[model samples]
Target: MFPKSLFPIALLSIISLGSVSAVDYSETYVGCVPIGTGTSGALYSPSVYIIEDCNFACADAGYTYAYFSNPASSFCSCKNTGPAPGDISSVASGNTNCGSFQATVNALATDYSFQSCYNSPASDDTTSQSTFDSCFERCSTYTNALVAPAGTTYTCLCSNTTPSGTAESCGYDGTFFAYSHTAISSPSLVDRRRRRLERMKRDEQLRLNRFCPGGLQACIVPGSDDSFECIDTSSELESCGGCLYGSYTNSTAPAGVDCSILRGAAFGGATCANGRCEISACREGFQLVDGKCQ
Candidate 1:
């Protein structure tokens, strides 16, 4: 658990597309504050260092913020509300540690070039006549970014469905350009892996629906998160064979009564037979007949 920090957004530095730095992301830098210094950051922690993935993940989750731990920052959450009085402190490394990641991402800068295409959309960052570096940097946030200098109707266009045209020479004048992001694995692959794990968990639970002790059965109590409990109804005093309030298991659930709670049978000596209640003794001044106290 990291110490929870609640500094105002004003204290952070939100980098724009024009900023000449190694790091490029939507969220601002909050210094080199370590994870132990703060509490858990967010629910989405990437196993690998794909800054874009972290940003897209936080944004998709409807969060306004995403943070990184530099070389290996696995924190991304929207918990930054505001700092307490006199709680604003710096981590000493401001954008200095950012270069390590930037250097790795910047290698692709030379690989990207403007292509030739039509129906070009407007620039995502709103600036035009973008050089290769600026265009690539500005379009980093987009999944399928297509950009070129002015005069393509729209300065920049991002379309995941549209296949990029043949790679064309990059220039300031109007010409279509596309980025493949071949440097890293597809972002959707990460989501697929997570979904696969969840499916496996569900499948495992379903498999266990019929597995339990010889006479015991799995039962899901009401209000439980789909979790089931193993119970034996044949001899349980409170529940002879199953739950009393309700049963929500995937298989046919057994319903039984509380053997010790029988009113017709002896209050203190009632016993369960298979799934029925038996009166072994009667209350004081009462005689047992026809399986009831008379």
Candidate 2:
């Protein structure tokens, strides 16, 4: 029998392992149909052959459609919709399939270029381009507007269909270019990835808030979310004040002054008093002035 204390660890391991499975591509096909390949939404490497791989690539690119040519020597194209303008026979049709993968579960498409067809009166409209993600996230709750303005920081509008404005190159301007997944055909695949990322973020936050294990103090390195070090703040000279505090070696005290300097041979004794460095006693012939040996 497994020990009771080991149950949580075992369960966490199971969940972690389950989240690493391949993207689900079942039920995404629209039958073997002919499609024009004149303007592909996005082109992928020729090495890809599996339909599931193409599905995921399209999802990542924030496109609703995917095209597979010559399944034997796979080539993938991602797009918003099919029936593009071109010669139908430009490519062989025996092993080609062009279709949109409707997510089986509710999922948001990220980095997609949205065209707002129309919007309700209460819908949010903003000129701040930085708020594009927030606007896109908001669209997920309502059904009317799935499309939001992209690549222009000046406006954020959502609508049911593609808006009538000129299509801007996504990520070109300093506007909200990346999109959040709102609706997709493959619910299971999109939702799974979203949930996994959310879980990882939550785990990281919890870890950051907790105390360091094994009697160690937590230290956060600048410019990193996942990098944390544990140290003994009381005795460690470098981490004298606390985590992320200035180093004692550099003469920059953490949040408080370092009393350890008074413990040297020049001073008899020192202590941290009320978050300040103080000298308890002075060495022979040395007088204490303002908590320092003079």
Provide TM-scores for the models.
0.26, 0.32
Clashes (backbone N, CA, C under 3 Å), per candidate, total 15, 18
Candidate 1 on 32-113: residue-level lDDT in tens? 2234332243333333245555544433333333454445444443322211112212233321243322211111112333
Model 1: residues >4 Å from true position, as ranges?
Answer: 1-211, 222-227, 250-254
What is the C-alpha local distance difference test score of candidate 2?
0.39
List runs of model 2 lying over 4 Å from the truth. Answer: 1-124, 129-132, 137-154, 162-168, 173-202, 205-215, 218-229, 232-238, 241-259, 262-294
C-alpha lDDT values of all predictions: 0.42, 0.39
lDDT of 1: 0.42
Residue 167 of model 2 has an lDDT of 32
Q: Measure candidate 1: CA RMSD.
A: 18.6
